[model samples]
Target: MIVFFHHLTLATTTTNPSYLTPSTARCNSTAVTSCTTTTSIIARCQSYEVSWNNHCYYLDGLGGNCTTGYSLATNAVLGCIATQFASKTYRSTISNNCCVWTADTYECYGFNNNCNTAGPFSAGPVWSGAGCLSVQQRYSAQLTFCGSN
Candidate 1:
């Protein structure tokens, strides 16, 4: 099997930007990199104890389907837009306080096999590019409300 890999970085452009996860977040004592501009309409994320007093608003989604686990994830969803994570993932876990609306179903940024930089995505939700093409791909908040489509 040919395994594809891509790296992602998120940033906020909204005036009232809220983080689904903190920029200096860490999991199992490992620092988690948070990106901005990621949001969703599924549920309003606020604050919570991710694991036994560990407070956070960390980004939760498929690292290997749209749900996270304790490690790098396995059989994860591919090409789906999300915060921080940009590769196929599943069952990965993060412990932290997330942003205002951290919906898993919503689009953020992920990798498409042979992923390359698509041009600037439109002004609205979030999208990703590998950095040198045109056209933006979009996902639905419906996904967040429900699950990966």
Candidate 2:
């Protein structure tokens, strides 16, 4: 099932017309043509968003321009975020499409059980351009201990 959020466009670029449009229908990870088409329409992040502490944030500028106290967000960071997200929420492995976005953007991911039909879906909205490839930490781990005599 697909869900549509309130549609609003802060800005649009000729490079990508799908900006802020209904994107839940794009990037069907199960279909190669669908995913390719989606990717082609959307542009990469101009600001290059990065996943930090399970949250997505855009860098100050392009070409790895990071501010003080902030380092570049690499694939490793995104992968770590994906791994953490998967383990905490579903306690399962991540899909191959996990952390697929190569730019700063918003991302929508599905649970491991339904990554195909659903997805860690991207190729949609770019952060500074056109796409929906962002992440937020919705779960946390708590440890419980038992004492034995």
Candidate 3:
């Protein structure tokens, strides 16, 4: 038999933009599990954490089927992360933007501006070139909410 363990440590410090406010900081820890057998395997992955001001957020996994779109998956993962990290909140104030992949065009598109301010319904860009021709490619965009400046 084989055993596997995973641990994640998140740490952050905030710098006050003005003299009237004081700096703040925090740190968090969580464990993820993965196991494998000769016939099958189970794994759990975590998205790269995003931090703004003093808050941190991450998607636990894809969370749902991406074939429809990322909105559902994004919302579900954010909710789960919020519940796990009680002290921090998902950046709901942030705009809902996703890097969508078009199978036919074989391109990955991002928001025109900051991911947070981009409108929710924007379809994004379409580009075609050498690296953009792979229909088997995959990409993802992650959004998180935090305190404003």
Clashes of each: 48, 15, 1
Highest lDDT: which candidate? Answer: 2
Ranking by lDDT: 2, 3, 1
CA lDDT scores, all candidates in order: 0.25, 0.28, 0.27
- Can you write out model 1's per-residue Cα lDDT over 1-149, one digit (the tens) per residue? 99988988788684622323222211121322333324333433233111111212223322221333222211112112233232322123331111112232222332333122222212212333222112222222111111221
TM-score of each: 0.19, 0.20, 0.19
Q: Write the per-residue lDDT of candidate 3 for residues 45-110, one digit (tens) a residue.
A: 223333322333332212122222122212212222322332222223332333323212222222
Which scores better on lDDT, 1 or 2?
Answer: 2
> lDDT (0-100) at residue 139 of candidate 1?
25
Off by over 4 Å in 3: 1-64, 67-99, 116-149
